[model samples]
Target chain A: MGLPRKDRIRAKLKSENTTVRVLLAHPMHTGRAKDEADTLIPAEFIQDIRCWRNDEEVLTIKCGTATARNPYFSFQLVGGKQGDMITIRWVDNRGAKGTTETVVK
Target chain B: MTDDIMQQRRAILKGAISASTLALVAASGLLLPRQLLAHWPKNAFNAETVEDALLALLGEADIADDAALNFKVGSPPSYAINGASVPIQIQSDLNNIERIAVLVENNPFPLAMSLELTPAVSLPIKSMIKIREDSPVIAIIRAEGKLYKTSRFVEVDIGGCG
Candidate 1:
């Protein structure tokens, strides 16, 4: 239940802003599902996500178990230029973490 | 004299306006302690019911049905995720958007995600959420120190994505 997941991040320069999309691979277990053995799986979902633009923290996302598996999120970042670095870090309820980074292009 | 009545009405209106202003000041005052000790808002996300979730997150605040805070779910059946993931696109013309959240009324865990964006982030967000069945998906936005919401019913044809 405390397994780490993979992350994919993409940041692109748009008209007036840079759009960033992040995809996280997680089971997002709700503690309600059962395996073939019929045991409840522990809830293991992302609880906190922090987005960073270079050194400054840009935003924080609070997510629950209801977020889909392999969650995808996209947002537009203003004043972003090509080659700027964007980073995403997340921690799930099980204390597992995933971090992804990309350069605006 | 009718002039006396007009004066009284104006005085009452002025008092009402000041009262509302004071109330606004007091409300923002409550946020100071919260910001000082901000966390993941566990009570809100843990709430099972929509009313409880809203109350826990935003307090007993007024919510306006805003048409400007619009959200679209995939309808071309391609957006019709046969599984748990349902894509949603949200765009808002409202100003001063401090926070945005998505909730599915029927999900066992209602609050899917909440975003705290800085001025650097613009609107027209696209995201995915887990929906088990047919339910109303509500997007709540905090803009201009007020809460605005718009909702749409999403039908999930299949079950868990796991």
Candidate 2:
């Protein structure tokens, strides 16, 4: 919940001068079931995912309920050069946070 | 004649009622609690360290097989497995990679990984991940030249929230 997905994406892209892809792991449960304690774990999941390089956003995804246990995403960052960074981040319905970073080389 | 007719009618109704009651009991008997508990895990998949995870993936061969291609994980994991959404990536700089496999150490299944890249794939892939606990993540890449391996350790504070 603390890391930024954009930074994660950027970190991967920065590894080489090419397109970078990322997938965020999220159970994306629909909150349709009760736990062993008979408590309802309300549906909380990533609602949107965005990736950026420098100041420009490379990929923006609006996720919905149909996504599976862990949502996987792939995208391309144009003009990746050495020392550049790509960042990817997502916000869930409950407003939780998760992010990753990749360096372009 | 009225009394005799009433007795026969009563006997038929009793038989029908018994038959239906037995059927209901039989159906309920099959739906037991023990049968439903089969899915619960006795232990949340636990492996002590990253090297242990790699050994589990390799399965007794123990020998380092450089012929096996490998993908490297970033120095630190991307996210905490708050809900098993820890991000991971794999890239192969090898020239003859034909297949790639990922294994999460502390998941319910140690072999909880998959990647089959054709020649068309650029010998690298990256994805987010779900980890049950802190453990090493292993990547097994195979190329025509040989087999190579890569691994990384992730520090997970919380598991996949059971």
Candidate 3:
């Protein structure tokens, strides 16, 4: 289950909407990369991602190994106000969970 | 429109920004589960080909181009020197968008990521993804219970398997 290191979320005011960008710290092994011994690394990548503004869930993303390591995403949330809590949560294929939150600015 | 449909439509229209309205749209957001184990779609993400993946995700429908969808892959070099992190942006003009999926046809697993969006989500979510080979980077938008798709060709100088 050893997979992720940490996760971070950033919320900012942009134009008419508040943009929330999340960065998940993960190795995102495709189960295809070989080691020095040329053995395939078992697939360990994020499978599900969920987002919430304050107490309400706003978005969900399902990702595969195609995503880059340290996956990053930016989504615009309507009515996201400063001081509102923005939470980013994720679970990997190995069943590891990581979550981080920040106040909208 | 029927009374229920009209009320739903009006709810979505006025609910675009309110917290209470977002809760209403979340029921139709396609994200039923809050925890992780039950939600990740194994079949669609693991499919090797695009058609099979789409079949699992969209229930076999004829997808047309919607002029309202604005998808742009940042001007990547003809040969993506850094195939690991390519930038892309998507914004939808269509109404009642429930899902937005980005698929790379040539990757080992074609479906990169699928966004389950609520009415609270505004458009133009810019993101970065890995591209290991030359493939058609496709964006599929599910709006108002219909399917619309568009794609751009991206070539990778260094491939995932090679």
Give the interface RMSD of each candidate: 1.5, 9.2, 1.6
Ranking by DockQ: 3, 1, 2
lDDT of each: 0.83, 0.54, 0.81
Ranked by TM-score, the better of candidates 1 and 3 is: 1
Off by over 4 Å in 2: A1-68, A73-105, B1-83
Lowest-sum lDDT 10-residue window in model 1 chain A: A1-10
Best by TM-score: 1
Q: TM-score per candidate, in order?
A: 0.82, 0.42, 0.82
lDDT for each residue of candidate 2 in B31-142, tens digit (9 for 90 to 100) = 4533532221212112334345445433343434553344444335433536355555565457645445466665544543333333333634555555667777666665
Tens digits of per-residue lDDT for model 2, A1-105: 433333223234434435665656666654654689988778766666666676665444444332335666553343467666677777777788887777775
lDDT of 1 by residue, B15-47 (tens): 999999989977879657546324789998989
Give the CAPRI class of candidate 3: medium
The lowest-lDDT stretch of 10 consecutive residues in candidate 3 chain B is B30-39
**In candidate 3, which residue pairs get closer than 3 Å at backbone N, Cα or C atoms, i.e. clash?**
none
Error of 3 at A34 (Å): 0.5
Instruction: Name the runs in model 1 displaced over 4 angstroms.
Output: A1-5, B1-38, B77-79
Q: Share of real interface contacts recovered by each model?
A: 0.86, 0.03, 0.82
Tell me which of candidates 1 and 3 scores higher on DockQ: 3
Docking class of 2: incorrect
